[model samples]
Target: MDRTTHTPTTDQSRPLPHVVVVGGGIAGLAAAARLRGVVGGGARARVTVLEASPRFGGKLMSGEVGGVGVDLGAESVLARRPEAITLAQAVGLADALQPPTTAKASIWTRGALRPMPTGHLMGVPGDLDALAASGVVSPEGLARAAEDATLPRTEVGADVAVGEYVAARLGREIVDRLVEPLLGGVYAGHADAISLAAAVPQLLAIAQRERSVIEGVHAALATAAQNPNPAPVFTGIDGGIGRLPGAVADACRAAGAELRTDTPVASLRRTAESWTVTTEGGEELAADAVVLAVPATVAARLLAELAPGAAAELGGIEYAGMALVTLAYHRAELGPLPGSGFLAPPVDGRAIKASTFSSNKWGWLDKAAPESFVLRTSLGRQAEEAVLDLDDAELVARSRADLREAAGITATPYATAVTRWHAGLPQYPVGHPERVARVESALAALPGLALCGAAYHGVGIPACIADGWRAATAVTAGEVSPDLVSGTK
Candidate 1:
């Protein structure tokens, strides 16, 4: 029952390193695959992926409902990032990618679904006049946003909450009205708790470097527009995000990396030279290098005995629960699927935070069919935790009511599907970067040990892939990358 797949081009008579990845999620898989590629087919280290669940991908899951595809976990990837796109091409799955169908999105505020302002990057509006014309925010809020140039520069470290920084620079109206909703949609976190440094370093750097957010935004936009071939605005597979995990898994297997499902890890301990891993079934494994690519909480528990200080700090990071409810209805039932989808402001007092017209978000989907429209609605954030507690029937009813008010849908849907994630999304609280730095610095002292996953840098798919690749590079050479170890350029 020894599950090890490795071939060393280096002198086999000499000692060869064995790597054990404690998590079958994408982070672990990416780390394993990248290490093999860098080390070459035969010289690559023996790699084993230990997963607690029956399958890989961690938070990424997809399934077909009534012959229609649905993504139960992460839905899309940002095209501007090089990690995901590069990984896709390297793994032989680049042909499956597609861009976001439209740049426009709807906002449910002040009454009904209205077109969101043009040139608005998340909550930071590029054109004040365009934002004022969108009717999403009040005139007073718009006026205040235009005055961000006068806001004084802040000396806060690279570990402050997004709410504290944005509200101080822009105004409470902007944060509560737009920034909070956008962050909640992405991280399912509270703005008051999410770290600007950890969750959005780009935004923080802009404010810190330029001393004026408006000028920074304009400069960045101009630079982006000048690129000969800019990346896609957004990306998703033709079928769903599930394709990504499958592709990564296939690549790992092709690279001769051992993969096991339904084999949950029981415990892990670090020794002077290597790690001793125990499985739930009492199996034991010894590896020269170890990668813990999972949630901070899971990694904390696994490394409690090895790195006590780091584990203690990691265990403090909190996560939130979320639910996705997809409703299918005839176009006549919901009326014309106007625009993209709508995001609900925190002040709206609604059960759902956002709803996307899935059928319209991608061209790969069959739009010529006379079938019903598919609307994917998300519920449960700090503003409304009770929504996650709702039963299937209740969730469907609540979604229907919200759609009726927001999208002018009156007729009932032909079908409804629901998926729930319990404490799935990690919340990077204020001072998160400093805490992560402490943990990483301590871990650097341990030989051939690397940590990767959404719990550290970012929650996006691209970020997770980049983290895994970085971790693999660090552990393969028995040294930590200065950029990754320091966590800042």
Candidate 2:
């Protein structure tokens, strides 16, 4: 349906339901798009998005490094989940989706670069032979991992730490050199603190059903192999993953949704029949529903008056700060880039947590700037914030040192850019699943108010999209109503 802007007038005869989605990130954009589909273009509903930042897209941003387009934040979407792909297709970005050029990655550990073991689920090796051949683990570590099959079943309660469980079954080497880096890449968290149920639910489920962790991994792998046509693990946009938000925002506007950037919401209030959203500039909007698509802290503050319980739960969620240093070097200086890039386990005592050889990993980058080798190195993870305190120049220098030590590159970067994400990634501790459930249940009591974002569910692009879709569905369907009133407000 084609959307057209309608002037707001004091005409009660034709009042249409209004939806105000706070935060113009991917989740808010997706929610606005889904709302348009639900309400259609004629006169079903009016949607307005308020973004605090000057630009939209949230973390999915891009910039030029060495005069070449590169993603400054999130770069890829997990293809296994259909939400992101579906949204992209809906927003006329179907043709722009591209898979990574190379999936091969290595782990820098034990003073050497080692091939990541195959047949593993998040570094939990399913094939002992593969793990042994990769030399990622010492002979003693390999033997310990193999013992999982014959060892007694581990008693896992409602939830367990991914690192604790894996280390008990395998060994510290697996947790340090393998699992830690892989999980760190995703959560920017330590495996010992991340919840098995929240971070790797599938593996957790398998472990619960099987006696051995390795056996569970093997079973999971077997199930995956049975699929005839598995989608590529990840997909990116042709220009950059950053292009996604622009497309989504355009789709929303085209569908008649009003999008305003740099408009931070100050407060939210509920009445007997409608909700009131106040912007920082003191403008008030009356809406039939509201979607709190902001970060945990922002969402908590907004929901405090509406749902104190949910607000408290959201406040408990912790976040990790990180910085990415993007550098461009002459291809001749770093002859023949190695496979995609390498990850550094904290055990390696490296300043950077992971590095992505952007030129080698993405075909578009390679084609865009063949003469320049573009790469990005990530610094700081979880509690490692001291490194992020350094100046941009120092951060770049440290990242360069890490790349040189890990990959044997001595070339000076022709250009460099630093992106810092403070409290960017949310940490899912052992009871994260339960906390999320509690937050959801508490919010369910307050109708017309729904929360969605990376903090509540899976952190991937697809998961956030799915969360947006769900929030849109709930608000549009009237499952959540603006009519409900709690004693708090």
Q: Against the true structure, whose lDDT is highest?
A: 2
Residue pairs that clash (backbone atoms under 3 angstroms), model 2: 447-481, 448-480, 448-481
The C-alpha TM-scores of every prediction are: 0.93, 0.94
lDDT for 57 in candidate 2 is 93
Off by over 4 Å in 1: 8-10, 14-16, 38-43, 331-334, 367-370, 382-386, 478-489
Candidate 2 yields a Cα-based lDDT of 0.85
Q: lDDT of all the models against the reference?
A: 0.77, 0.85
Judge candidate 1 at residue 377 and give its lDDT: 89
- Candidate 2 stretches greater than 4 Å from native: 1-15, 38-44, 478-489
